[model samples]
Target chain A: MRAEETMNKLPANPERATLEGKNKFLGFWFFLGGETVLFASLFGVYLGLRKATNGGVTSQELFELPLVFIATMLLLTSSLTAVFATMSLKSQNFKAMIGWLVITVILGFSFLGLEIYEFNHYVHEYEHTIRSSAWGSAFYTLVGTHGAHVLFGVSWITLLIVRNFGRGLNLYNAPKFYVAALYWHFVDVVWVFIFTVVYLMGKVG
Target chain B: MGSHQNDSVSKHDQSHLDIHHKIAHQKELKQHIVSFAMMIFLTMLSFIAVASEAISTRFAILFILVLAGIQAAFQLYIWMHLSHKGHQYPTWGIFFGIGVAATCVAAGAAMIW
Candidate 1:
């Protein structure tokens, strides 16, 4: 009876209230740590081979500021929405949490759409296929890996929302949402570097 | 009988704590908005530094890199809650990864020339 009563009223940090939740939180961060290294190596490779364009096109010619800026804004806003969702989850406002997450999912989709369009434009208009040049190979591999992460995040969150629609918020599902949001934010963090090192620097040179 | 009475008292206290938690959450909401705004401003600054002809290429590169570092800090600390309590292990784990990553980048870049 006591446990049931306490369960109904969320603890201060519902995401870390249970042993399982705490484990998930710690484990996910470690996973993100590994992911950072993975991306860093790819970044290193891209930076090394960025100048080898093989006479097709260069970074300055192929990358556009406008499209990248729009995509960055979309992903950044989605990260904020995910934060809001986590906040609502803490306050035990089930509907508010879901509302924020739905908005996040929408923003994620918009960002992905923009990326797909950007890649399509690059391939068709610029002839910048991965096989075209060493620079192209490195660029696509690095950015494409990041894109794959975005796709994974979008799919993960959508499944979470669907699977738990009937169940509402509970301890079992709270950590799931919290960890997913963290993953989403990490993806945004990677993009922050991508835009800077890949896009802006490419433009400058 | 005594246990039942104590339970009631704790329940009363729990309700009091809930109010405080809500107030704290409201404050955190403001922090989130401020951080987001700051990130947007920094991004624009980086873009302008590159887009304008006034800034030299070498300087623009350095300036934008510094801005990116600042923005990444905001995302990690504020948005990702790395500054919050109970994140000590996370701090260690991520930093270690960053250390390895920096080495990898240095090695890869050095191979070019």
Candidate 2:
């Protein structure tokens, strides 16, 4: 009985307890590193063409702080919830982890909704769009790319939760949960730049 | 690799390990909450820096960018667990990406002129 108890015990970090888990964990970070470069290129293009409004609405005139602020808050809070999910994963509390992930997904959806509303408002009210001008194209591409990421994250977490609802926490699925949380956090990290360079910087000018 | 030895430990020792893990996780949780609060404060500060007319455009841009850097560090190191042990390779990967990203941003800025 004692031997079985020890055998059944989970490692402190069940996610990286095995070679496969370790590989998944490291590979995901490397993937995030690659993702950083991808977004950086987009950011570069946006910066170069940000001034070319081509008689369309300028960034300063088009951006509203309250909307952007709310979106940032939503995403930032979602990042925290994802962290909580990770903590729960570490402690092997499958239900709490799912609960936290659900909250994270909800926040992600809220952020995406705000982005859609913001884009629609810009198009209808100010005529700013991807086809409007260089600046318009740059703005939409950079911010829209981020919005798409939020959508992807929301979907990813939802699927993870649903698919794993019945499969309790174990080494097999623990790394998956950990990796998903990492991806969600990476999404938020990208937004930190977006809000700073795209929205906040645009407002400052 | 050595985790197999854990199977030989008595049940009482195993529970002790579990308790230790729980205590450590609790402490880590508190630190994460503190980091979260700091991030929120920084975000608000950046927004206010841009919203107010008191700060010049040049200064506000620089200030907010700095804040963004700090906030990103907090997320990466604390929330992402990059600060924990066994993250050496992950750190290298991320820094390399950031280095290349910096070059890309510089190139983009150079195109502006």
Candidate 3:
């Protein structure tokens, strides 16, 4: 029984307690680093074309602070929940970790719902489609890419939870969960910039 | 490589390691709480800076962008544990990636003119 307990409950760094775990952990961070550059390039393009609105609705006219604010709060809170999930993972509390992760997924879905609503509102009310202007293209590409990322993250986490439902937290699976949590946080980090650069900056003019 | 062997090591060895891990976890938990509060506050402050009209719009944009930077750093280091020990390679990978990102952003910006 003691040996069984030991097998499951590894160390605080359960994700990196083995050589394979170490590789996965390091590789994921490096992947995140690469992702950083990918997003940065998009941001650069968006900044350059933010004002070329081709006689359609301008950002200042379209962006409503309240909706964006609610979205930000939802995502920010979700990031915190993911952190809680990671903490629970460290302590080997499988149920609590899943509980927190589920909350994280819920918040992510809420944010995605708001984003979809925001996009639909803009399209129907203002006809602000991607082809409307250069500004429109940049805006959609940058924010849309981010929206795609959120979609991917939600799918990723939900699948992990479902797939691992039968298997308790073990050495093989902890790294996967840890990296998923990291990716979720990275998603939040990206949104921090998007809200600041895209939404908040767009509202300024 | 032999994590299985490591796992099979005597229970005495693990209990010894567990004490240190418990202490480290306590510290990490406190850090998470403090950073979460700080992040919320920063987000609020950025929004307030924009809504207040106390500053020029351009200045508010710049100010909030800087706040975003700080928030990202906090998330990366504290929440992601990028600053933790044994992360030296990840540290290099990220900073090098940042260097490339900076160059990419700058190169893209120059095409604006």
Instruction: List each model's interface RMSD.
Output: 3.6, 2.2, 2.9
Candidate 1 lDDT, tens digit per residue, A85-155?
98898788988998998999999999989999999999999899999999999999999999999999999
Superposition error at A98 for model 1 (Å): 1.1
Q: What TM-score does each prediction get for chain A alone?
A: 0.97, 0.96, 0.96
Tens-place lDDT per residue, model 3, A1-205, is: 3564646556556898778989999999899889989998988888888888999999999999999999999999999999999999988999999999999999999999999999999999999999999988888898999999999999999999999988888889999999999999999998999999888888887
lDDT of 2 at A103: 92
User: Which whole-number lDDT from 0 to 100 does residue A177 have in model 2?
Assistant: 92
Q: Judged by TM-score, which candidate is best?
A: 2
The TM-score of predicted model 2 comes to 0.96
Is 1 or 2 the stronger prediction by lDDT? 1
lDDT of 2 by residue, A1-205 (tens): 3463446556668899889999999999899889999899989988898889998788899899999899999999999999999999877889999999999999999898888899999999998989999888888888888888888888988998999899888889999999999999999999999999998999877
Q: List the residue pairs that clash in candidate 1.
A: none
- Report the error of model 3 at residue B113, Å: 3.4
Q: What's the best-to-worst order under TM-score? A: 2, 1, 3
In model 3, which regions exceed 4 Å deviation?
A1-8, B1-19
Error of 2 at A85 (Å): 0.6
Worst 10 residues of 2 chain A by lDDT: A1-10
Residue range B1-113, candidate 2, lDDT tens digits: 23444436766876777788778988998999999999999999999999999999999999999999999999999999999989999999999999999989889867775
